[model samples]
Target: MDRARKDMIVKEILYWKDNRMLPEHYCDYLLALYTEGNRPKDKARKAKGFYFLNIILLLLIPLSLLFIYFTELSFILQMGLLIFFTITGVSLAIYFTNKGIAPQLPLAVSALILLLISVEMASHFFPHHNTALYGALMLNCLLWIAAAWKFRQHYFGISGLVGLIIIVISIFI
Candidate 1:
């Protein structure tokens, strides 16, 4: 084949790999056959950076929990920190999902952070209202179920259903 044709094929294969239009192994094999084993170097570097960023984002989950439980910061400051962490987690999740990377960890972390934020804010604002707290929990569970449907994740749905059951039991007993 001509050089132009080969280059076009390689670019197409790269696009397939990046967007997950084809399985990664298939894309790799095609790229290797087309490029004669000279794959792009920058992809490896970018992958390393993404891996590092993923680790940092994962670490932020635990750090946010610690900040919420251990610190004595003012309520506004705590809320600000939580919002920042939640936004970062959610943004990373969306980016990873679009790039065909493993997005489950970031998505799960964001959901957990959101749950914490909702519960904490509800309890803080309605310290004496058990009904309000239950409402907040129920709302979070519904959000999880909605997210599960949107994302096609069974675990999220199961967890939300279980949460609803538990909340109902608590309310009765």
Candidate 2:
């Protein structure tokens, strides 16, 4: 590819990642066959779960903003969140490269938690912005349900219940 075309492709990939793109067969591949090198290692170990969870968080970008909207968080708390996400994101990326992600990846788990909390806050506190609110609610709900069904209780089944509640309320609201 020409220099310009190559640059465009690189930019597209970056955009897709920023948007948290998930593959269709991502869940399906969890069980079909095991890749020998896919397991986690140690301090150098990389958890695949954390890796993919980070991707899913891309979709949560809007929802995270919703969190900032409703919650009466202190400036420190907000800054803390920013730092925590950045650190965890970078750590998980390293793990992804090292194949240290043995079983459950921490990033995926964190995303599920973040999604649930954000959805709940949006549902309970934010009373307006039907479009943005509903979109976050529905998206989080579906993702939660899918994650629960695929990973089972291992990924925190509580999120499934939360998603169900959000979906019902979304329908009514």
Candidate 3:
């Protein structure tokens, strides 16, 4: 096909896509075929390993839950696992996000949950140190804020801000 004609067809296909006039897969195929040589290579194509890691991390969620629910593990062991998973999830989130994937949201969320679990565990272990407990809470909030700043993800930043506010309120009360 002539370049001009191909460009026109590509535009028409994109119009159809925007209007949902054609099936998504068909539109995608046409777009890829027509724009293959013209478009720059997508940045996402470079991070194949990050994509694979994300998939593995997702698959582990159910298994992790099963281990927590079905096993008669001791409290210390469970806390240890939660801490390990939290660190893993947060690290993966930071790593993948720097490489250009937005799919790390779940990992970030899992890390946030693990931080909460860690806080709960700490409270149980050292019941008398209110100052230390608040400090730990602030540290978790800072981690969220740091991740949010690094990834440019507003949700994490907002949540961290809210958490900080709550901590302040708790201290005053």
The better candidate by TM-score, 1 or 3, is 1
The alpha-carbon lDDT assigned to residue 78 of candidate 1 equals 86
Off by over 4 Å in 1: 1-36, 40-47
**Most lDDT-accurate candidate:** 1
Q: Tens digits of per-residue lDDT for model 2 on 54-96?
A: 5665645554565456678864575467446545644654555
- List TM-scores for all candidates, in order: 0.76, 0.34, 0.53
Query: For candidate 3, which ten residues in a row score worst on lDDT?
Result: 37-46
Question: Over the full model, what C-alpha lDDT does candidate 1 score relative to the true structure?
Answer: 0.88
- Which pairs clash in model 1? none
Residue 2, model 3: Cα distance from true site in angstroms: 28
User: What TM-score should be assigned to candidate 2?
Assistant: 0.34
Model 3 TM-score relative to the real fold: 0.53
lDDT of 2: 0.53
Alpha-carbon lDDT of model 3? 0.73
Model 3 per-residue lDDT tens digits across residues 1-173: 89899889888987787567998789888888998846554356556766677776775566556546688888777667766776777777766655456745555657555665756666878888888788888888888789788767787788889999999999999
